[model samples]
Target: MKFTFRKYERINKQKEIDAVITGGRKFFENGLLVYILKTDRNYSRIAILVSSKVEKSAVIRNKFKRRIREIFRLNKYKIKTPVDIVVVATQISVRQKYKILEESFLKILNQNGILNL
Candidate 1:
């Protein structure tokens, strides 16, 4: 399986983001709020949301986004089912390291049966 977070593998449209954030199943743990919507599409897509509450600086916010995206990008191919995922970083995420965030993210998905791995 290909492991890449390409442009097409990103949820960029406002409508798509809203749909995933509002209509998907919600899971929260370790400073991450994840919304996952199962889809028929063969490929999965994702979006990372880091609000001002998480960080005041754009650099920090982007850093968080990149970390979350990397976690998703590396393990996305392991997802048994295709899903549109929206990951929102809570205030605490700004203080969490990438390893902690990744572990929490994967654990949540695995525990909820959203991800095969």
Candidate 2:
């Protein structure tokens, strides 16, 4: 599988993000928060959010986003459902290792019944 995060696979518009946040089903595990909404498209789209409340530094926030994005990018194929997913980072996320984040993310996907694996 290609390990690329394409533009079509990302939720960039603020209105879309707001809609997902407001209308999606929410799930949380080990400092990782996920909001998932079923979409009309055959493929899934994703957004990664790390607020200032989670970390004071912009660098740290960006790092968190990058890590989450990488995790999703690597495991995107595991998800069978077509949905819009918004991933939010919490304060505890900054301290967790990459493996833990991956596990937490997969747990969320499994709980949502989106993971095919």
Candidate 3:
């Protein structure tokens, strides 16, 4: 899979984010929270959120966002259905390792039947 995160693949609009949060089904594993809403597009779009409540430092928050985005980018192909996915990081995620985060993310995807593998 190409490991590029493109602009079209990102859910950046506030209205879109709100729709996903309000209309999507939710899944939680470890410190990772996921909201998924089916869309008409052929490919999935994603948003990663690292709240200030999770970490006070901007660097820490960005790190979490990057890690989650990387995980999603790498596993994007596993999702057969077209959907909008929003990933929210918790305070515990600030200190967690990338592997832990990846595992938790995959677990939630599997639970939601979004991951083909």
Candidate 4:
């Protein structure tokens, strides 16, 4: 089955912030990183952040977002908890392959105890 993260689940509301800030954590790995805040709900959400400082063009930024989303879609099962994940891209990410980026992200999630495997 194909699993997806929708926009409405994103941590945009004040209530979401309170849930995260009171009990959230972060993780980092080569070429990828994540900030995860567990939620009491039963779903996951994602926000892919690519700053213009890394890629000035909107096209490039969107490309980065797409790559991040695709990676998350393929590996969402690794995460066993309901959480909000924010992925912020760096300059090095633009030069890395998708596999490397996905691996790095998974590593971080695993380290943070967010991933079951």
Candidate 5:
């Protein structure tokens, strides 16, 4: 598959904030807490937030975001809805592996009833 979450799927509306924050369920793991909210669309969007306090280097922070994006891209087939997903990385994730991140992410999707299998 072509691993990508396409630009069109990105959520940038102000109205989505509440659903992303309050309505979304939290999925905790060593690296981050993933908050996923279901949207009434045909595709999904992803937002990643990494606190400056977690990593001092901009390059490192960007890398984390890229990794998260890749994870979502590669696993898009497992997801079934056009949900809005926000990934907030904790300090622990800075030192973790990509596989671990993917596992944690998939676990959250399953917990939130967003996965297909």
Candidate 6:
């Protein structure tokens, strides 16, 4: 499959985001705050939130967003159900290496029981 995160696969609508924020199950692991809500769609969608409080530099924030997005983009297909996912990064995440970040993300997926193998 082509490695790409399309606009449709992103949780960009305010209503959708708000629903996840208000009702999704929350998980905190490896400096990442994950919010997930089951959806009726055929596929999952994602959003990455990196607040300025996490880092003062826009460059750093964008970089962190890209890394988190990439991690989700690559592993999203493994999810067994359709879900709206929001990944919020904390300050501790900025200092971690890519591998560690990926591991942490996978751990969260595993913990949620959504990861298929």
True-structure lDDT of candidate 1: 0.87
Q: lDDT per residue, candidate 4, 13-85, as tens digits? A: 6565555545667666775656788777787777766778887888877877888888778777777988888
Prediction 4 TM-score vs. true: 0.79
Candidate 6 C-alpha lDDT tens digits along 20-52: 989999988878788999899999899988888
**25 in model 6: Cα distance from truth in Å?**
0.6
Worst 10 residues of 4 by lDDT: 14-23
Pick the lDDT winner. Answer: 2
Sorted by lDDT (best first), the order is 2, 3, 6, 1, 5, 4
After superposition, the stretches of candidate 4 with alpha carbons farther than 4 Å from their true spots are 5-23
Candidate 5 least-lDDT 10 residues: 9-18
Q: On residues 1-117, what C-alpha lDDT tens digit does candidate 5 reach at each position?
A: 666668876666656755797898777876578888887878888888888999898988899888889988888877888788888878898667888888888887887788999
- Give the Å shift of residue 104 in candidate 1: 0.8
Judge candidate 2 against the unseen true structure and give its global Cα lDDT, from 0 to 1.
0.90
Show the colliding residue pairs in model 3: none
For candidate 4, the lDDT comes to 0.74
> Candidate 3 at residue 70, lDDT?
92
Write the residue-wise lDDT of candidate 2 on 1-117 in tens digits.
888999999999999999999999999899888999999999899999887887999988888888888988998888898999999888998768889998998998998899998
Model 1 lDDT tens row, 1-117: 777679989999989999997899998887788899999899889988888876888988998888988999899877888899898888888678999999998987897687874
User: Which TM-score value belongs to model 6?
Assistant: 0.93
The models' CA-based lDDT, in order, is 0.87, 0.90, 0.89, 0.74, 0.81, 0.87
Best by TM-score: 3
| Superior candidate under TM-score, 2 versus 6 | 2
RMSD of each: 1.2, 1.1, 1.0, 2.7, 1.8, 1.1
Candidate 3: segments with Cα more than 4 A from true spot: none
